[model samples]
Target: MAASVQGGRIGNLPAEANAFVGRRLELAEIAGLLGAERLVTLTGPGGVGKSRLALRAAHAARAGFPGGAWLVELSELRDPDLLTNTVAQATRLTEQTLRPLLQAVCEHLSGAPVLLVLDTCEHVLDECARIAQELLASVPELRILATSRQPLGVPGEHLLTVAPLPLGERDDAVALFTARAAAAVPSFALTDANRAHVAAVCARLDGIPLALELAAVRLRGFSLHRLLEGLDSRFDLLVSPARPRLARHQTLRTAIGWSHELCTPLERLLWARLSVFTGGWDVEAAEFVCHGGPLDAEEILALLASLTEKSIVTRDDEGAAVRYRMLDTVRSFGAEWLTGLGEAEAVRSRHRDYFRWIARQGEAEWLGPGQRMWAERLTAEHANLRLAIEECMTAREPETALELTGTLWFFWFACGFAEEGRTYLERALRRARAGGGPEHTLAVWAHRLVTVVADDLEAAESVSAAYVWLAEERRLPVPALPLTGASLAVRGESARSAVLYGSVRQAPAGDGGAEFFQLLTLAVQAYLLAGQAAFERCAAVAERLRAECAKRGELWMGAWGDFFVSLAGIGLGHPDEAVLPAREALAAKWRVHDRIGAAAVTDLLVVAQASRGEEELAARLLGISRRLWHAAGLPQLGRPDLSVFHREYERRLRAALGDACFTEAVRKGRELGPDAALALALGDTADAPGP
Candidate 1:
């Protein structure tokens, strides 16, 4: 199952939503180059339609390769280390295992006649080149079509440089303008009255497709004659003499600069401030980050509408909300203006503050019915959050950096970014230590969480020691202590975990919902390891926590509460009572992308199934759990309280299924994707039905 979009022919080469205007000769040459060479690199300036041309070429050339043509968008990717994983994901190699992700990708494409179209590789140029070279070397049948600002510089790479649309009597640029104008202004047409004027405008804009479209959108208000006159004046003012050789670049800059000059002061201000966002921002986010000073909160909506009208920002209607974003080139221009005005630091400070609040709110609300919703919103803003973190670090604002990084612990962990989260946390920690200040409670908590998530026992001990002192100094009942106990238990230190839990106490009733759930999780794990008497106590606390969560509408930890109940039922020999709660916990964790938690719950569900004498079903779930654990990047640290029974269940299932069948069943589970695994664990038959 390749990652196909809504409109595609062979594999995920997206069908053009808007009619492609004119790239006839370029397309012909590209097709020839692609056929002649296995790796064809498309090089061009920004806004020159490099990505569009590459995509069209890939789409047209799809039939040549039997395995299909696939496009992996690299514009939104910031981490080079994830290049292989991202490509694999695009190709839908969904198996989760401990193997190197690149090896998995090589295994998928090895000797397969496939065409991989890598778009926007300029940012991760080196990494993309390395990947392309490795992949092509191993898979002789693989062809790579990459678009970048320059060539990939790999061996045997064929370069095709894309230039702007040609002007003159060809009318290609004019045809493009006319088509877009008709969409923008339905009554608009290319007649003898205005055909020359439209051609002149296209000539002024250097026939750049992006520039022409941006200019075309303005037809809603301006007559052709007046638009041409205004472009003449703005181009003279914005054209830099130093870059005369780069005509298309200058034309694009002039076009964007002209758009900026046409904006109202408030619109311009909003544009500059909006540059702070890396991805896109909704009206709500724009209002929060761009308001104050001369721009009032109420005025932001009107100004944003104006910018959208002028094509300074593009509006995206995703799901239920409208998001506004600037193209990369446009955003860069705005950022330069912001820096010129000496408001760069101020604007980024506001950005960091706004997103930090978002992180804290998400942390507080993650345990409720809105858990999945918050996760989705946070995922959408991930780029902005990363930008904010970078701003904090670069500005030498350690306190802010520490707080922001710490606040995002739940988001990073629950969203399966544990390793990346650790990187940011460590950076912030070094900054804090350099500043010679005591670590704040929030920062300490964040570090401790990261340490535990990364399974770094040595770092966990250091972080917990620091947190313990900070919690006492502030007289705050840190929720992270019990997390430390869980980490200890994972390290096979049940006795030490028991001793640690002896000192850890539940937060006061009025403390917070998250803290209470944290306490309950510790109670269940720590006390169960302590023995049967402590296990009963743990059961009572679990019941209380579940009732309170249900009463208060807490969803995330309430599911964990369900997990605890299932655990108690297993320990108490009530397998029937365990099934439903185990399923409930699995569903909740799956919804929030809690891979580690989901894996642990799957293991518990298998125990319950085995207890019901369903040995085959139990064996299948055991396989699914292994897949889940691999996805989590964590080892199977068995539940200390039930390890004996859990092992016995595995042993009995292996004997019943036989070696070959058991291995096949496990492979079947490994093949079950995240969604199907969740469905199966929750008692729904997989899409194909049957194990």
Candidate 2:
């Protein structure tokens, strides 16, 4: 599923794993500010719970903003240039156009009331401020809740300084400590025997949620009296009364340092090394990236469990897999220690190398039964992949960057990241050329294909010419011949496209070793045949492709096959027979979060419904298709052959329903949310409107 489709909301705010002990008043205030102000920043020192408060407030206010609340995490993002792209991706605005990214983001949000919580903005303050300002000015109903150490300095910004929890006998800090302590040790509780000690520990830690939680977890290894003594000594040595302003900041640092000191040497080594990951990483990634020297791969799981028990690292079981992440404050501490150990570069290199291996593996297996699995795994690793590419560019390893980008073309193309892929490919190509790096043929062709899919024909043609030259020099067959045929078909050259596509089908079995590409070739050929009025040939090819994809357990390419089969059925004057396959294709596309494919299948449904004399349904479906295309950031499929059918069927519907009824139906269809629209399109009578 798309990241935006979290439950029914278009956001990715994580569910709170533990009880929210405090922040009741702050939550109310932040909620009120969000209602009155367009932009609000929760400013405070690190580990004062800014991110947690922001998430709580956003979730509480989610209902008011129908567009859904989204969290845009900036901690893992290092390069300032990717701020906007990161926001766009987090908001799930898959802009498949050449327009400026910020412009597309604004346009996507202009029509809806969205709440965006930008977490960890201090590092990219200027960029965040600029984008926040632009988004606020351009989008009328958009609200942003930012968590930063300092203000964004944007106009109309409301600043809410988050403070640590209050410490007292029955305050939130003690309650939080008690709650966490219970989790750490089931027998622990707030009794007369230990209540005073727990309160003392919270007070000494300044009632900071993170610090208190860290202290509570120490109950697993230390007695209450011993934990209190350890904190007393650590605080006295670390905090100077002369620097009151930095006292809480220093105290939190001291707490984190104390935790570090308590770790075994191997655990400390692993902690520092795991800081190299961006976003959350699974156990497998942790093992591959952090295992070396004193840290053995087999010891990683136990080490991870220990850290989780210590509350230094958190585990998330909400996704398809279990993943772990350090809070930004904790991660920063680990990063500093890693640097202090003089192992930052080596660990980061290993991080990049692991992801590079992952990319190659994903590319090799993407055509098989693991297609969906690879897509989800790679999507989960999106941030790490970007970091790896960024590191390559920073280290002036453009050849590595080029090859990595090339290897991930399937991910970018089939997984709804074509625009992002184009951005990386263009950057890598430019850098490689400037640095005089060898031009990898795969990278060159990958760039051409992504560019074409993103509707940048001019840029794609330029890169295609380069690839053609390179192919001749190397005396090898072009691997992108199917892409060339696709471009030709898009430009109304059906005859030439057919011949090129036929040549690809006739190539040797081991020619490309890319079953995905072969399936795509067949789908494209089916579309071409349909456009040429050869219904039988189109049906046959589409069915064959669909059977192949089904046997391989692939849904993306198979959905395309379903679409073509429906299209050919309608062309063969069997509208009734097209309905089932059209509905099936639409559902499958939506399942894979293929907005573009969903829109295409919805268009086919419109034609199918219209041919069956369901003019009203067709008009409504046309509206839904328009909305889907708008969401996909495209006018249509960008295929002239497909466009011809849509235009013809739409004209017929307009005449049959008349302008007024057609317009009203379309309006209603456009108003439906994703779930409701899909339900209605799938013939769920409950969601169907009255005539």
Candidate 3:
């Protein structure tokens, strides 16, 4: 009933990779389509990963074809004149010139059973149409997988549209984000506090994978509510002309515009208002952030339901119970029009306030599972979270200003989000300090937080005076003592900070904040600056603190606990002993976008690695630390102190290792500071020095 591709052969491939995701059904469907059709064309809106799916499917079904499978990546070839050459390349045909290439491919595959994967052929649809027609007529036993935005205008070509993943199930987009977030931010898991919200965010993303990916990246900086708000206002910021071809395909704003032109006014406003979050938000956030107060709760609910029907907004699988999000594109489109309507500031104010409320809720939850959940939610809303801080600081809303800064502490430190955190916290502190009240306590908190995330300590050190002023002038009877002390210590008052923490520890810490924070002070004093015995003392104290935190179900401070433990391990000259905790700390810190935490722990990890003869790893990590530190405008690590370690590290490490800490910085890695960078450089040398 259908054409048979027999005796066609495909060539060698990259090691059958599994790094790719979500194509099982497509693969199967493609297999079935190939078995049943002469020519099959897979079509999607764009960036549907059609080529990837086709290649994977072809790889998997190659055995069935026996002649093998081949790929013609048509996306690169714009000249129709080069179509034959492109085909020749895909078939691996040698060409003295392009003259004989097409004929040569036709002859070469005459007796072979092969499947040809034609990727991204939409732009040159005519050329593809001609090629497919010619190849099928002459070769008899060839199958093709051609991807185009629209049909290739070829006969016998069956089209398959790859839609976004279904959000009807519980583990659809939310599950995908959960898996991807954990991958990007290791050990990240969906927690009860954010389960509903995360699901809602995923659903609103309309299950578009790339949109989902960008949202996940945002999780490194802000809350879900914060992300939503950005989604509300992003079109205003995201619109810059891209390369014409790319502008349509790559920009979320364009993608949403395509969808938004299909919506009504109220629907568009509803969409913009929904953008007031990074993660899912409650009905309260939506009503306050989106509606102009004239719209009652009931009317708003019905409008939201209407958006879901058009796929403009998606409620989570539990239906109306959860919060909502917009697909990145949808949100972008909504934001564009929201700005165009001159309602940007009015709506954005609502968006900011909603984030403030969410941040306060998140702050209250910082002590429990809520800590992780809200942290992740914030991580997804980095853009909006930042906007909220800017709005509050500019508007001089002291409470909102401080809380937005404080609420993000966990996320900023956990996921290595120090850069963004420092920006907003500084502005917030400036506002809080200018206002001059009990809010000064918050200004101190802001300064301390900014310091930790500041890659460049020099810039942050200027604010050290303010941290001290807060302690001297506004040190609350609250346990914010260690926080202030730790800030001061990091700014260079180590001995005094050690004593400051001692006072907090001495005070009867009846509950949560004091105990958890004071641990930071003691750890800083005993290990960061002290000798071997002091490290042991720090270790003992940290171990006790860790157990106490565990007993109270407070793992929020685990990164800090692990950081101290690794320091003790490194101080003891047992770098190997430091490895596990250091690695764990790095992973945990990254999980929550705690950039400073990751950097601090990595510094210790490098010390341990250098001590243990992992010179190459040390060198790589050292480089990373330096980059991170520089980005934060912080002062450099003691190059003189680190030189000895670097030299020693080179003596032992002849080979660098561990994917060099993410692909973009494979050579330099994102370690901690100059100390770590020196170690990494040493490790990179083939003839490294031995310990």
Best by lDDT: 2
* Stretches of candidate 3 exceeding 4 Å from the true structure: 1-284, 291-305, 314-347, 393-417, 425-435, 452-475, 478-517, 528-535, 551-557, 570-577, 603-640, 655-691
Could you tell me every candidate's TM-score relative to the true structure?
0.79, 0.91, 0.48
TM-score of 1: 0.79
Alpha-carbon shift of residue 438 in model 2 (angstroms): 6.9
Q: Give the TM-score of candidate 3.
A: 0.48
lDDT per residue for candidate 1 within 205-224, as digits (tens), equals 88998899889987887888
RMSD of 1: 5.3
lDDT of 3 by residue, 179-206 (tens): 6666556656788877877776665565
Candidate 3 Cα deviation (angstroms), residue 39: 37
lDDT of each: 0.73, 0.80, 0.58
The clash numbers for all candidates, in the given order, read 0, 0, 81
lDDT of 1 at 486: 57
